[model samples]
Target: MDSASVPFAALDYIIFGVYLFIIIGLGLWVSREKEGRQKDSSDYFLASKSLPFWAIGSSLIASNISAEQFIGMSGSGFRVGLAIASYEWMAAVTLLVIAYFFLPIYLEKEIFTMPQFLEQRYDGRVRMLLAIFWLLVYVFVNLTSVLYMGGLSMNIIMGLPLWGSIAGLALFATAYSLYGGLKAVAWTDVVQVVVLVGGGLLTTWVALDAYGGSSTGPVGGLTQLMGDASNRFNMILFEGELMYQNDEGVTQDAYQLLPGLSVLFGGLWVANLFYWGCNQYIIQRALAAKNLQEAKRGLAFAAYLKLLLPLIVVVPGIVAFALDAPIQRGDEAYPWLLGQYVGTGFRGLAFAALVAAIVSSLASMMNSASTIFTMDLYRNYVEEEVSESKLVRIGRIVALACIVVATLVAPQLADLDQVFQYIQEYTGFVSPGVLAIFVMGLFWSKATPNAALVSAVLSIPLSAAFKFLTPEIAFLNRMLIVFFVSVALIVGISYVENRGETHPKAIDLDDVEHDSDPIFQVAAFGILGITAALYVIFW
Candidate 1:
């Protein structure tokens, strides 16, 4: 390695040191308020439903924007083109739907963990199965991915060994999550989101400035750099290619919606609804809001935040590609871009921001996992009589234990070339089943516990077949096919098993109100309008 390329310097370390201190301090500050409370399951799990909309919204954004976006999504942008940005842009609509269509049911019911809703709709067995599945998925896919990539990003930025970075992240996450729970994660995330977005925009601006200042001069310079003349067909055509993957750095188009129709329709929609609407790690913050109005406001805030995410996470990636930086691996772009454009004091702050993003994600996942374990799994199955204080104590222990296990697994994450792909591949195992069961439970009264269990059981093998048997089929297409098949299986079997007798309780949608903030509606429309304008421009 070159002398300049050592993983970190005193400056980088100092920045990270300050970041760690502030985050831990925030955790301690949030913990102070809970010092003498009853420390019940509700308090340990949902922060006693006392958070404001801004804090919940910021925490949601921070939890979602991990090293995966900074490292993986940006790297994908470098390899392919702007097409990879759909993940960010499309989520705006998803969040809007969640805010208006989904959050009401959850907030109205006052559910602690989402799996609890499954029990209310189905049975204890379904709830237990889902809780276990979600718990494992969080630890293996979400938690591990966050820590593994966070460590890798730090190593690349600082010129340190990967293990050192992993240890550092683990220690920081453990301190915040174990000591403070959701309260700590939420407040620290507020600071984390600001730093991360600022750092990302700074990187993107530097990249664009570099591209625009070339000898060719601004417009000519940017166009020539961004275009691949030899791949005319790729540039004009969009559907056939996965927007996020470029076989060899080709400038594939993002204009056509046909290729990813499934993702645009049900596949991506299902994932987003499941993720933002019902998932523990993402929605736990929303559930911690002081009231239904606050929860709705928080979700609207997150929706607005989602609309702006592409500016921070996706645009820099496009810049990376425009600069002709090597992005054979999607996880390499952010570090490569940061290493190229950043220097000195700013580098320290940017590095600190990246660290904060990773820690925020880790803390979110760890806290959520602890919640599911303590409230859904342990309280229901293992220890039914623990007091509130003891429950909190158990949650702290569970959080630390999960961190240790995930850290050990972090080193093995190196072989997973594309972090986002790895996340989807593993998550697909359970996401489809979970999504199916949740949708049915919420909207279909006739859906039985047996049907939920059977659909979940059958969806796994069907998903695996799509993964291994038809390897050439796009992942999004496979998800759509799996979703329909699972739906068919569940509905068909339920009809037959019930002998044409449907459950008599009708879902009361009349009680659901349409009271979303006007600002959010405007922002949602603006996102759609911008997407349409982009399509027109490219066409």
Candidate 2:
């Protein structure tokens, strides 16, 4: 599967080049500082807290829908069918919850990073600990995984070497993000989202057209694909229903990944909430909103976008399976389709879309990692009265260092069969406990800092013990156990330490009134209703 084997024409290269130029130009132009006013830490990190609803919304989706969704989740679609879409569909509901419940608290406090919120609620020690944890996850897990998947896609489709692809992506992301910071990442994301979605839809349409043959239109092609591969569209899987036999000669069930109806009601919620509400890279865009109403509107926009993702990512993989496309692995399904069906000009646009996904995510992650380090650790711990210019410089240095580290680690993940699932399974160890702590710290007035600290420390070990000790339980189910145990520890410790003293609330939820926005309320409820309807239809 060399580059020569793929149908990449001169037109495709020209299209890709044009796309790169336009995006880089746009990112720089939008993020440039005013003539006289140098960019302070506020401008560099939080987009000067001036982002409108549309930029916030588009940036949120661009930051989230990376190579993982494009390459890895599509691979899951190829292997496990529509059941894999629970991640996307369930996330819609999670976004709604974050918009209404979480945004009010965050905006009221006017925090730059999630760690800052922790410091306000608990203490500086807790904030520092979580800040370091987030930095490590962003560099190693988030940055490295996106690089690996993006490189892998380029290798399969364009015949580029993996290392070169990784290096190119790292440098490209750093070019604008390091200088312009989140403003560049967010505003450029507006265009990237459009290109990503449009190009993705083009790939799907072209692939379906090819599958249907010349005479049949896209509608007939879709109908034929559905009727022929009806089994692949089932959104639920029961135990003992074998999906595929692995290299170890063990037949794995679909329930192993999705775990039945629990996807709707159980541990998936913990994963989604932690990702949408608490995660730095995903939530940073929303945090930069000019107002709570704007942030809420942005999240609602993201929710609507989430609904359309399965069409671009999951449907293409299912179509590949329907055509019985030959490929070595499930992750190869997307690139394989692009090479096979997409024509010369369209192929370039599609490749640009993939690059858009990879680059936007890389920029977003780098900016967030920089934000946490500069704000949480350096400015607070090392230099209490750090100058704004010096802080911006430190952030750029940190962003570059993160990219270098992630590039070094990207190649190591090549052996993973499904990188998307790999990320989810490993992150589950911490997400559940972290979510538990946040939930209690926000709502439960009795939660002590010690209790929150203990839960954070124990989450990984508890999740690991369950993984190695009870190998048969699904990872999602294991997350539920970790969450409950962590919550119980927090509650028990808080009760003992507080000792009948009723402290003030950790977060003054009543201080900010977020319920007045009727349009936002209507949109939020609409999203919720749509989510419910989707589950019912899929179920």
Question: What are the models' TM-scores?
Answer: 0.90, 0.97
Q: Count clashes in each candidate, considering only residues at least 3 apart in sequence or on different chains.
A: 5, 0
Model 2's TM-score against the true structure: 0.97
| lDDT by residue (tens digit), candidate 1, 236-320 | 2345444434445554433322244454565666566667777899988878998766776676677667666765666666666
Runs in model 1 lying further than 4 Å from the true structure: 2-12, 34-38, 214-259, 326-328, 499-507, 513-520
Q: How close is candidate 1 to the true structure, as a TM-score?
A: 0.90
lDDT of 2 by residue, 1-539 (tens): 56323857999999999999998998889877668988998899899999999999899999999899999988888877778888998898889889878889988888999999999999888899889989988998999999999998899888888999999999999987888999999999999999999999999889888888879977778878878877767676777663764324456787878888779888899899999999999889888999888999999899889988998999898888887777766778898888888899999999999999999999999999999999999989999999999999999999999999999999999877778888999889889889988998887888888989999999899999999999899999999989999999999998899974544547766676676788777887888787778777766
> How close to the true structure is residue 141 of candidate 2, measured as C-alpha lDDT?
93
Measured with C-alpha atoms, the lDDT of residue 161 in candidate 1 is 79
